[model samples]
Target: MAIRLRVLLALGCALLTAGCASGSEMTFRQDKRLTIVSPGTGKTVRLPVKVSWTMRDFTAVRAGSPVRAGTGYYAIFLDKYPMAPGKSLGSLVTNGDCAGVSGCPDAAYLAQHLNVFVTSGTSYTIDAVPSSGTLGSSSHYLTIILVDGAGRRIGDSSWTTSFTVAGAAS
Candidate 1:
């Protein structure tokens, strides 16, 4: 038993060392890029839904922090992508209503009004969603975008997936 434990420990150490040598905390697949891990496309899910995703070469930072290279938070859009003519969700909330003020829309406003949830983590749990237009279930789109600390989008780093909510009849 002791020898076996030592062997396991040694293997774990070697793997850790290899990962450190690679200089990346996580190993990502080239083709895998940014992808949703659960509640797959076309799958039906329940409320308090858990959504997870994975990305490459990026770090999730807390909102309102100073913008750092390769470090940002995620903006999750449920149903429709909040767009007002040429304005974005962040811009509209910041420059339009709030008038370019810092922390204008805030987190609560985003979730309650716009269905836009923000998080620094890799996963988010949706407590509730809109009712389905049809009977039984409804399809919704989940869009995840990497945004900077100031709530602006970072380049074109965005991913989208569709799923159904069971028992969300209208």
Candidate 2:
């Protein structure tokens, strides 16, 4: 009787532990894709253009919120590739204001530009305004990644698209 009771107790504990595991502990599906819908690749556009994209199979949530299974936020990468797994999106430069600023200022600027929380829907739009004084023509690359609550990138665009910024130059 004692041995049987111990076995039952151990089984109960194992089930409890499994149930307590957070969503972050589970493996996220990689079948989702992030696609840029606006300002198509190789196209020329004026300043203050609208950038849009679509994501599938992943639930979009507000940053800093409790992460749910299969739910996360988006991070925009401009002119750079997405960070590797386990890298924090906060380290990347996503806006022009980050220049000449150190520490919090830089982080604040990046936070504003890079991390985009989708309150609802799979499609999102953001404005891209040129900060460069002169912009006769410039090639800009954009990509996005889906990050879990822990700031780990779980999904990303396979390719970065290039678009030209015209009329921004003096």
Candidate 3:
């Protein structure tokens, strides 16, 4: 009876291992996050403005690398939100957004639709700030989105912050 019980336990352990290997486990990639560390939101700053950030549970790779899960670069948008291709007004999208590390966009397509500054590094410097409207509202929104090396947007990994550009009032 003891031998039979041991055999049953062994079988149970094998089943659990098989379940894990077959992707029956819930993997939480949502914990992967990015945070802007400099130029606090709502703060006024001068140009050539330097923006920096911190990444957790993610890997930043250079452009042109093979599209892979959890590996990508940053696309910095000025006064704009990073939207998936055709979703953007007047966007002549020819490629799709990255979904779960697949269907990544190439650099050219992203540049045409997203209008972003691509970088693998954590920091970037904005040399020029666009002119504010007649209201002289120098406030601007800077957003950062993670994308695969192929330039496709990653899963929900985007952040935005606002700051006034010094001397941006027109």
| Winning model by lDDT | 1
Q: Candidate 3 on 68-118: residue-level lDDT in tens?
A: 888988888877667673232223243434444443344444444555577
lDDT of each: 0.76, 0.60, 0.70
> TM-scores of the models, in the given order?
0.70, 0.57, 0.63
Q: Model 2 over residues 7-106: C-alpha lDDT tens digits?
A: 9999999998877878997875644466777779888877665667777777777656576778877666665467886666554544545566544233
Q: Pairs clashing in candidate 2?
A: 134-169, 135-168, 135-169
Off by over 4 Å in 2: 1-32, 93-108, 111-137, 155-159
- On a 0 to 100 scale, what is the lDDT of residue 55 in model 1? 80
Q: Mind giving the per-residue lDDT tens digits that candidate 1 earns over 1-170?
A: 99999999999999888756554745543344678997798788888789998887888888888988888888888886644322344664543666656666888878987789999988999998877522234788888877877777776545778888877774
Models sorted by lDDT, best on top: 1, 3, 2
> Which residue ranges in model 1 land beyond 4 Å of their true spot?
1-32, 82-89, 94-102, 133-137
Clashes of 1: 0
